[model samples]
Target: MTSTPLHKGIHPVLEQDHPYIFIDACMQAWPDADYAHAHRHGVTAYAVTAFHPWAGLDEALEGLMFWHLSARRHSHLGIAWIAEDIRHAKREGRAVFVLASQGGDFISNALHRIEAFYRLGLRMLIPAYSRTNAICGGCLDRADGGLTSFGELVVAECNRVGLLLDCSHVGKRSSLEIIERSAAPVVFSHSNPKRLVDNPRNIDDEQILACAARGGVIGLAPWGPLVMKPGSRTRPTLDDFVEHIDYVAQLTGSADHIGIGTDMSLGTYPDHEHDPWGEPAYAAVTREYDQHVTADVRSPLRAVEGFSSYPEVLNLVDRLQRRGYGEADVRKILGENMLRVFEQVWR
Candidate 1:
């Protein structure tokens, strides 16, 4: 007798026809992969990291333009400026693209650029990345100075333009301050919980509660060290990834505040050297940090068995089912939670 498929009678959330909304909270646009490959991944939406603190204003603009041009080149891609755009992309069987700035450096200290970038289809902004900026302290900064006057101004501008504020790479004090300051819900678009793994890039219990208190959702990142115990020789399993989700759920007493933001890039950092915006561009951004410090900043080089790519999201869903997560909760974790925040903040 032939065996039935594993997902054949699984929870509806694990079904391919369940109208799944897989959104990667953070990812880099690789020159080689392009939008064509991105559309084929079965992900409904992606928040592409078009700008970061390390890039100069001009380079940031270039990166934004590259995404714009790619969207124009690919018929299956459209910029998701609002929640409706995401719904429309799903309806049209295409991938919704949302540009995100990983740092305020994209504005070059100019406040007016917020609206301009919004018009250009940037839906999310992280006030700081890994170092101190005029607006706020970065996670790796020497001091957690919190949000500066200019940073408050940026938060206000982002709120005014309906841009979703992200606190992923921001320092603890600054992240909390931004959450408290913003009228809209804030997101740690691609961050893990520090309670699970003690890393600068991870958010703490207080931070997680603050974000949930503001009705924000924390997108669990799948970067190696963040997912697994620090310095573990073994790769993180799908269960390790879910533990972050479960921690946030149990901590917040609701799965509504948690979602996936696996910060997977097209390829490793070294592979981008041949691209137009390659090592030189990234190097300029990390010049202040010691060489050793900047070298290990990329996502974990090792691939987890079932948590490798977008399609592996199904694996996550299956694992969630095995873990006894209800279908509604699974749906929320898969995408509804993030979409709810998007609808609220992107208005």
Candidate 2:
């Protein structure tokens, strides 16, 4: 029996790397599943933020939401009201805090609130999630409309304040409009190329190209849905993940426009649970729904097949050595592309 080879080329020089990663954003459901442990991975930098249930006007609750993150060094915990704590964390060499919202709902239809959040170190905003709200429509929405008037205002203000606007969950039309409206380069923080998996959540080839044309970076996620073929009975393998990355690189014609987000949900939430905020966790919606679970969504084993951690992922450079992606290209996919987007949009 032959073992699988995870890498083929020279291993990446992670020691020289800042080891920085923007997890795109995630919910706090299970710590072991969703949160990245720097000590475990030897990751030097991370910008961690919540994914949903916009932090409301309650400052105390918001503080509590982010307070736990302060204990971790080299993490950027995100929340709406933890500005002071985030600043302090950054100074302490903990995690640099970055306030992020999954939807514009954090401001509740008020674009002015963006300025307030920006003042508080809000670095990124997702115009929509699976559902549309006041500012813009989402991909799952039936209307398929573009950004609303307020959405445009928010985009402009995000630009003015030097915030990175993430179009990952926005509707196809809205994402296109946002690229046109943003004054700064935008990001598709944790998306994959639809050409590979045909997911509505993934960006289309044209969308990928448009984003790259505006100096934006699209971070590819290493999750079940992104790499799986529709109706296929197969768990995502390293080759599948690389295929999506390769497709995006081809779509953009440069590895510099793509980066890895991984989107690994290690310990955040139970795979079978779904609920908003403090609401009760919902069980699998229906018995029929149980049958919908695809092979790709199977609970990931510790190492996720070939790679267990970021360092393991670096081994990909070795695997693709003869695939025409050189060391520089590998570095770009691992972090440089994201850094370029960060420097451009987080000004």
Error of 2 at 112 (Å): 2.7
Which residue runs of candidate 1 sit more than 4 Å off their true CA positions? 1-18, 271-303
Q: CA lDDT, every prediction?
A: 0.76, 0.59
Provide the global lDDT of candidate 1 against the true structure: 0.76
Q: How many residue pairs clash in each candidate?
A: 1, 19
What TM-score does candidate 2 get on C-alpha atoms?
A: 0.75
lDDT (Cα) of model 2: 0.59
- TM-score against truth, every candidate: 0.85, 0.75
Candidate 1 local lDDT, 198-280, one digit each (tens) = 76678899999999999999999776656666545566677888889889999999898988887776533432235556422
Compared with the true structure, what per-residue lDDT tens digits does model 2 show for residues 223-333? 655566666554556776788778887777778788766544323333434466664322221222124433323334212345434556645655656578887887677
